[model samples]
Target: MPITTNGIHHEERGSGDRTIVLLPGFGCSIACWAEIAPLLDGYRTILMDLPGHAGSVGAHADGDLPTLAETVYDACREIGLTRFIVAGLSLGGAISMRIALDHPDEVEAVLGIMPWNAGGTSAGDPVIEGFNAAYGDIETITAGITSISNDPTKTTDLLHTMPTVTEKMWRGWLGGGAFTSMADKLPGLRVPAFYLVGGKDFVVNQAKQIDDVRSIPGGRLVLHADLGHLACYEEPELVAREMLNFLDTHAIAPA
Candidate 1:
């Protein structure tokens, strides 16, 4: 795995003209992209483990969103990618938004999955609070992840393969502060964007999620009715097809 200054670990594949950067959610690693990557074989893809997760343990800078976004930007710069389409899931979506907002010149488009939007408190507040409360115990946190993942067996296997983090690291990430700060910046995005959410995602209000991103000039929403928060895992082929179509429609360079 290649390492970045901010402690992210990544794997690069393909040699296409267009680059697709995959950012996983909390507690997940590059392994989260296992199913999606093969579908994007024609495009250059970069899958990264966020700090303190998987191969990037001990690389945590600040749990805050801006710092994490800068880390992502640095990683992309290090890899010689001047611009790319960023596709992020959950927490990754929040980071992608920050990157798109802070580095518009380097972002061609954004695909936000179950994204956390800019709002101090909305219908999703209780969901976030529940997550924070559960983060007090690692077992609880793990269980929560398993409950939400589309494939519990695969998700558990992937998680069990990673290096463990301290309670503080887990708590800091799930405490909700970082997401709150990230969500507060949604209204300022200027790039073309796609917002995706599983139709069955109870953790986030799908209607609100769509409405939030729809407010952006060129943003549109796509809902996978049969999937949940882990839509990518539950419906990789469908998600991949939708993403590829979006890219094609936006005239994003192919890998």
Candidate 2:
């Protein structure tokens, strides 16, 4: 794992034909992608822990979406990744969207999994708030995440390696100011994109969000009826396979 001054922790694997940057959701560390990354062994995968999460707990910034996007961009630059597919879940998905909109030259494509549109309410807001209230209380926070996670055992194992996050970071996660503002910028984004959602997700309307994304030329949507908010974890192998297929359709060059 490599660490950046801005408090981003990342692990890289399989220097293959394509570079796939994986970003986790709010309060989640890079380990969230543990099951998913290995499945992408034929491709280069970079799993990143956003600031204020995991080993990067003290990492600080404006804590807004744009700043988060820049932080990701900086992390990629620090590691010499200029062009790659940026895939994100939940909050990470929103950040990926911002990156695609603001720095199209650096991002070849975006995979947004259970992404929250800034204009809508998050389905798991109550759960997130309750967890944040117990930020330093590791047990409480862990329990909260497990309740929402598709696989409690795997998620708990991953969380055990990280320190408790702060209330500020939690606030940043819930604040959709950055995501909501992104609607205005979407029209300008030309990158090939994939919008994925779990059919059971109640945090946001999958169909509506997909409709919004489809307004963009070449945008595609995928919905898994058996999954929910944490679809990547619930179906890592399937998601990884679908991701590779999407990339192939989009013609993303291998690294």
Highest-scoring model, lDDT: 2
Model 1 bad stretches (over 4 Å): 120-126, 136-138, 158-168, 178-188
Q: What's the CA RMSD for each of the models?
A: 2.8, 2.9
> Number of clashing residue pairs in every model?
5, 5
**Which lDDT tens digits does candidate 1 get at residues 162-216?**
2264445566655633455444456677677887778677666676676677566
TM-score of each: 0.87, 0.86
Error of model 1, residue 108, in angstroms: 0.7
Residue pairs whose backbone atoms clash in candidate 1: 16-255, 17-255, 117-183, 118-183, 118-184
Screening candidate 2 with a backbone cut-off below 3 angstroms (N, C-alpha, C), the clashing residue pairs are 17-254, 17-255, 18-255, 118-180, 123-203
Q: Please list the residue runs of candidate 2 whose C-alpha ends up more than 4 Å from where it truly belongs after superposition.
A: 118-134, 137-143, 158-163, 175-179
